[model samples]
Target: MTTRLNPYLGFKDNAREAMTFYQTVFGGELALSTFGEFQASEDPAEKEKIMHGMLTTDSGLVLMGADTPNSMSYTPGDNYSVSLSGEDEGELRGFWEKLSGSGTVTVPLERAPWGDTFGMCTDGFGVAWLVNIAGAQQQEAQP
Candidate 1:
């Protein structure tokens, strides 16, 4: 088995909705486990909340998210951002449209200073994203 690094989002209470929305955007298999299902929480309210949710897209994108328990502190900030970079212009642009929909676009998707097309946006769930469409030369170099 190989180890991989993916984004693990921490939502206050909308892990299910947020993860589901991502499934629409990325077209993936979503597996969700609730606190009750995992027997991880005793409180009835927390039982229905998601303990862990994993979405594996066909494009090899893995996204994980979970609801934050009351016992834990959740501070939303600009500490982290999920980045999507590739040479597929159409595919990446489609992602940009879906991600930026109903969300705030900090940077429009267009030509960037470095010669690549790039953009930044925060989804409705308040998760920040950075999308970059690599130049022709960069794509050919990838294995």
Candidate 2:
């Protein structure tokens, strides 16, 4: 497998729900491990909470998430945005619709000034996303 960069989301308690919702949107295999299973938490209330969750899609998308332990400070969103960019209009648009429909579309997906279809949204899980289709990104000049 090739090394790739993907988003890892952190949730206070809804990591399982959020990750499962992402499976529906992206059509991926989701594997979740609970705190009890991992023996990571001694609190009974947190035993069932997700310790880690990974969603791997056939399209080479890996999205990971985990529930924040009670000891850690949890803040949702306003940190980073997961960006999806490619030339596949159909696939990218499908993702945008599902994601935006579930939450808020901060920027409508349309022709962007950068010569691509661009949009921004924050999913129900409080995760920000930027989607770009058929982008004409700057390329290096040939020698």
TM-score list, all predictions = 0.54, 0.53
Candidate with maximal lDDT: 1
lDDT of 1 by residue, 1-143 (tens): 13243566888889999999999999989999898886767788899999768899888888877887887667776434676766777778888899999699987998765567878788999878878787774556669
Per-residue lDDT of model 2, residues 64-91, tens digit only: 7788789765766643467676666667
State, as a TM-score between 0 and 1, how close model 2 is to the true structure: 0.53
lDDT of each prediction vs. the true structure?
Answer: 0.79, 0.77
Tell me the TM-score of model 1: 0.54
Which 10-residue window in model 1 sums to the lowest lDDT? 1-10
Candidate 1 stretches greater than 4 Å from native: 78-143
Name the lDDT of candidate 1.
0.79
